[model samples]
Target: IKDHLKHHQTQTTCWDHPRMAELYQSLADLNNVRFSAYRTAMKLRRLQKALCLDLLSMQAACELFEQQALKQNEQLLDVPQLLSCLSGLYQRLEQSHAHLVNVPLCVDMCLNWLLNVYDTGRSGKIRTLSFKTGIVSLCKAHLEDKYRFLFRQVASATGFCDQRRLGLLLHDSIQIPRQLGEVASFGGSNIEPSVRSCFQFANNKPELDAAMFLDWMRLEPQSMVWLPVLHRVAAAETAKHQAKCNICKECPIIGFRYRSLKHFNYDICQSCFFSGRVAKGHKMQYPMVEYCTPTTSGEDVRDFAKVLKNKFRTKRYFAKHPRMGYLPVQTILEGDNMET
Candidate 1:
């Protein structure tokens, strides 16, 4: 018990434990049980906030760091300068995130993520390009916008990325899941497989333009799935449905609202849905639709019709035919390196 307590104290991140990976994956799977990217992203954003790991917005990060007058993509910030910048970011975070009251601990975790993702060698210095890439990858922006911004960071003057440039982008993007302790769910930290998959998707071309890169991104590669999910989360950040959670009885369901297709007027709040709670007869396997925004009259009628249809479906049918929420692309390397 003494040794266990000591180990816990020494651990830096909340997800440093072996079980944390499984916990995060399970939570993600549970939140996205029906395979909606928007739902999955909302859960992750909640988790990120709860863990106090959601860093500054892209605009805020740019404002804070851009003031340094450093050369674009060529300058470097050593440990002291990096911490100073993080300190400023933390001050802004504290105003919004109440959980970030612990200034030292929060700043330390933020610094750790930045260094682990951008300064993997622990040289105590990070390139301006790497820093911007890391911030943009984790920022609150549209997934496609983030993708274009990241690609621009690595792309040549002709707006093309060679194998080496693509590899760099993947390397930095993978670190978000790594820092969140969810890297194992996304195929570990190795970026080679993801890079190879991208190039192969582009027909093994020597270089890929923005159009080719966007095509691959649309497939939702395992390593970068979180980016799209983050976008969904941001979309629904302020959404409030005019409904009550059947289980928890919370009014005006905030965030993603889940409405049952099998039952009339049955609604579940994000909290109840995430906790796997159900009312009297509603089963976990029942078909339901998620809404990040309020439903219109037409959408309500369409959902009602779908619900009436599902009512005729048997329990066995639902069990036999499970629905997938997202179609994640599995690369050739993934198939070759099957665990079992």
Candidate 2:
């Protein structure tokens, strides 16, 4: 009894406490054998939450000390199971702490715990699960314009999106991909431009995080992974934008900025093969390839590699000759059609 009663706050957890013994005792008196499964599941959920509270406490302490090294005497826990418990607690928070939640603490603590777990150098099995768990919770938190950080980390780990912070399509959507929920992969035409929303939901990182809505516009060449979804997002935008340009009303592009002119005329439509500017030498228009190429960046080729499926949503269209920034391997068929 003393072993159970004598407690350490860090050792004391919600799992052992939330399902108050009193509740079980009361349920025992009901003797409803037919309802045992429901009762048991509810009881289990409560236990998981309790465990999460303690795990979070420990995680907080670990983070507080910047303890990258696992403690010599940390509890002997099933790392994966413990991580799962933490995730369950977070998922349930939407049901309970959805209102009074400490937004920043939740974000910082979870990310710290996750970054530590990932660097633990163990068999990366738990790392994978822990990351997915932390990410889902992270998606729930306010982005606070933190997509770049998450984007960079994920890009390094998964090779999905560029880490350059390119200020383009990503700024619009807010969503992230879950490894278990969606098998993030190259599209190879598996997805189309019409249903980009479904692709974003399944693969788009920027869509997974709403930082774009908060105004973090940038133009650095980062890797954009999650290409299949990006194509859909781009296709959707292109379809909608095709009508925005006045000179090329039927062009395939959604919206475009000027690439530069052979002599500065705005009448040329790249997609339609309307070479040369209007009669009075207008700035070439429609296919604005130069501005889209992002020549200012000095990134390596891999720097532009799309690591995950989500980054494709904001893939850039830059010139192929001495390309300005790193570009996604898909789509982006090269610039120069305007001259042809």
Candidate 3:
């Protein structure tokens, strides 16, 4: 099965051309591989239907298992645990679902079900920690011999298996639905909402060595893992040992600032913060603070380039103000006092 999956990944099919082009372009590489479009489309259509059937079969299996467990008065651990139950449910579905002429491998079917659960209410591929935890949890449930072998192939004790690794594991065994391409398009910024609860922000840059990443994956309540802080540290190390502002990746004369307690080491120039610059996770409500300045007044110093950068970066702010010609004319007869 592993050999078959490997073969499948390397095989060229018509449906893959578009995605292959996109992938190759992203890496600035290309190949002269050609394939029969009509034949590939037909194969893809069949594969698509097979994938849908497998999903429906698994969903039915899950619902049936839940009903039986409920009748037995047994309480499941958590969403992850409930999902791990897919391993036990697949066997029952195979025997009952005669219409499923093309049954995917048991492990592939179960892993796909788990992936569906992890991707719920979020976009992008599942991160390494969540992926590793889910697979290990399923293995602990005591799956059949063949199923255990497949799961172990994709899992490791040292670290998480990324999507590329998973793709290789299941590539030939089952066809990935086109919908997966759309989900992948959403990217990392659309991480699962519950997963976001795992980390808290910091006021200063963080130390994100390999050890720190492993500890963060342990999900310890007291372990403080600030992503922004780690990002700053990584950027500094890679970009010629200089820490660029998070908002504008340039030198910070006045220093960077951040407002969110949920964020750490996420520095932005004073200009970007005060002028209402906004990005994916950061917003205006978070307050800003200055760093490495001798005096408080120096923190407020706004450079010309920084100010201009903020103006363009925050066009939405300028859009709200009315034109100067529309200003209300002040009347001397008004009850309110006016200075001349």
Candidate 4:
């Protein structure tokens, strides 16, 4: 009995034992489940306030959208499933009758454009060049401002707006409030209004985080319902600002500048090149000509080629007309760095 007591004293308790640690963790988790849920609700409320969206409904719609997207992509869709999905989408779209009429046309246009881009008997997958060019073509062809902004997000120097960003942007911007309850049902009971109310009550104060809001805004290109109005405004704003040089990032407000053919978004100012302030990655050997004004002269072709060869010797520039005695070149005078 004394030995047993001594052994018991030496032996670690269940709480101290590593083997029983998982139970304590699970207990702690169980205790905090309500708190965790409350925190999530608060986050959703904040997101809702920031975006002017119903978070619960948005969550539901997102789940449905994702499920449908997955099912459609996986070749798992039967006729009934396809019809049901279509009906759901149509029903959701009908709430915003204005968009319902235009969405189909836009989808059809995008599909047709994608098909044309892959017309070379190649794989169904779109190459990066094809994707970029296809977006440019779509933007030019579509009269809708929504599409213009969408394509511009991808085509402009703002940077690449790939598939994920596109999905997230559309998910957040497009409202399908009518379908939210149905979507939530599909997601589960966790996002019900009653539960969300508890979360809102926990932190019932107006707290605006400017940086977070800015970040969200940066991702969202524009609102769908106000596209037409915003489109005209955007066009005017675009016209007011000239394309800046990619190297110096200066506009041609004072004089002409050159843009690179190698990259769709890259351009260089004469001042930057002359003053050796040219940003890296814009190869000097890459052909750049004046975008808004003429800098090319037939007389300076040979001298220009020599100068170019000397200046960009580190990089390779193949002459398109090798047999010709000389190639035509453009001359551009340096600009003031202060003006850059």
Off by over 4 Å in 4: 1-61, 66-75, 94-340
Ranking by lDDT: 1, 3, 4, 2
Instruction: Show the lowest summed lDDT stretch of 10 residues, model 4.
Output: 331-340
Which is better, 1 or 4, measured by lDDT?
1
Candidate 1 lDDT over residue span 64-89, tens digit each: 76676544665788756666766676
TM-score: which is higher, 1 or 2?
Answer: 1
State how far residue 327 of model 4 sits from its true place (Å).
21
lDDT of 3 by residue, 1-340 (tens): 4443453347422123333334324422111111111112223233333333323332353355455453221122333333344334544555766556333354344344434535444332343334333333222122223233333344445444343433333331221222222122112223332122222211122222223333333331111112112222222222321234676665642433332322444555534543446567765433333332222434334332344444344435533421111012111111121110
Q: Any idea what lDDT model 3 has?
A: 0.33
TM-score of 1: 0.66
Clashes of each: 1, 47, 2, 1
The positional error of residue 109 in candidate 3, measured at the CA in angstroms, is 4.2
lDDT digits (tens) for residues 36-117 of candidate 2:
2122323322322332431233234234223333232122334343334344445445455565444333332443344333
Looking at model 2, residue 88 earns an lDDT score of: 47
* TM-scores for all predictions: 0.66, 0.25, 0.21, 0.22
lDDT of 4 by residue, 196-217 (tens): 2222333432221323223333
Clashing residue pairs in candidate 4, if any? 246-267
Pairwise lDDT winner, candidates 1 and 3: 1
Candidate 4 residue-wise lDDT at 132? 27
Residue 265, model 4: lDDT of 50
Off by over 4 Å in 3: 1-48, 51-62, 65-84, 99-104, 112-188, 191-340
Of the candidates numbered 2 and 4, which has the greater lDDT value? 4
